[model samples]
Target chain A: MRKNRSPKPPEPCLLTECMQVIAGAWAPNVIWSLRAGPRRFNELKTDIPPVSSKVLSARLSELEERGVLVRHVRPTSPPSVEYELTALGEELIPALEAIVEVGHKLKQLRGYEPASEAAE
Target chain B: MRKNRSPKPPEPCLLTECMQVIAGAWAPNVIWSLRAGPRRFNELKTDIPPVSSKVLSARLSELEERGVLVRHVRPTSPPSVEYELTALGEELIPALEAIVEVGHKLKQLRGYEPASEAAE
Candidate 1:
């Protein structure tokens, strides 16, 4: 007699959702800068050069909505706002670190060095 | 007297490079499917529904060029080709796993269930 077997449950495509969070061109750079600490909008703009003010604001809002980052409004003559990573966002660091490791390995295999390093 | 201090060397942005590999919309899905084993072009297309033939072929070629996957051509009456992950590609699995874990947490926090589960 054949024993009955239950079909395996369909695993949700979690990686796809995660990738959506970081798919923005400047999302990783923004997250990387915030790893040091929280920053005001202007500070973030300064830290991540080449990103326009409009785009930066948009990405920040997107991250906040996704729960990856939090927006805190400070009470002052002019209310100051700062953005920082949430617990959920912090959880992404290890994965980012792993990606970095794999990326370095790929670069090494391809014999492609960063321009700054090449200049040095 | 101030002691001489060597400047910290600039670290390369490995995450950016890694992101380039998976930047394509279908990249993660393709990589995830390949995790099981090698597959032919047609097999991949079938596995990843909704992707057009042109886009799928481009993604395959791009992945192969990035050193993430290898394309093997088998000699037969009609040559058969299969694509499989390289060691570097295999290295990305852990990172992907981590991302998936974080994604699940995010989705749970949002109280959003997948459509399949919602149907049940």
Candidate 2:
């Protein structure tokens, strides 16, 4: 779900603030899952197998609080909940991909594992 | 000092570890400063004015411990020290810039302050 296009100019040296928010333990994974568009909580947990329900719920809440993701509730009989990226959250895709690119490269440099893309 | 060029493919769905490591309060700033090359502890503190000495020291140590940076000690008359990105650390530049790009866009969407680059 990560967006991989677009190479923009060097940003202000002060962007560490953005990094701090997205750097949370489950934030990146949540962002990546949302890249495919909005999904229900169970779908998200399915896509990202390791995150516990409580932790995922907490992370979703935190991302919403940080303006990174939006949570929606549908007025169904039992109530359905969905999570999606807000404009702010979608904007993070490129940056997160950039980090992934670096991770891929580091893996190559360390002779560890090649990036999923490179392996394919 | 954030690297702005090079847009590679989207990485595996599991790069949150790298983000977590660099997402510390002072870590991004430290990475930005180190992008130009190595610097002494005091120089880092000067470039990123908000961080305290203890925090900077702790962040640098944390980054070094995470394999993102290297600390070098010089046997100067007064004992000098320097910190630089390890290969892994240097590799983070593009990803960091990517995050900055997202931040810039978010600012645009939210009607918040523009990225430093656009302001310049």
The RMSD (Cα, Å) of candidate 2 is: 11.3
- Candidate 1 lDDT, tens digit per residue, B1-120? 222122211343667677777768688777877776787777777666777999988998878777778899999667878889877778777777777777777676666422222332
What does candidate 2 score on TM?
0.75
* TM-scores, each model vs. reference: 0.75, 0.75
Give the winner by DockQ: 1
Tens-digit per-residue lDDT, B1-120, candidate 2? 222122222443537656666766778878877887788877777677789999998898778766788899999887879898987787888877776767666656656523223432
Which pairs, if any, clash in model 2? Answer: A95-B98, A95-B99, A98-B95
In order of listing, the candidates' clash counts read 0, 3
Report how closely model 1 matches the true complex, as a DockQ value: 0.31
- If you superpose only chain B onto the true chain B, what TM-score does each candidate give? 0.75, 0.75
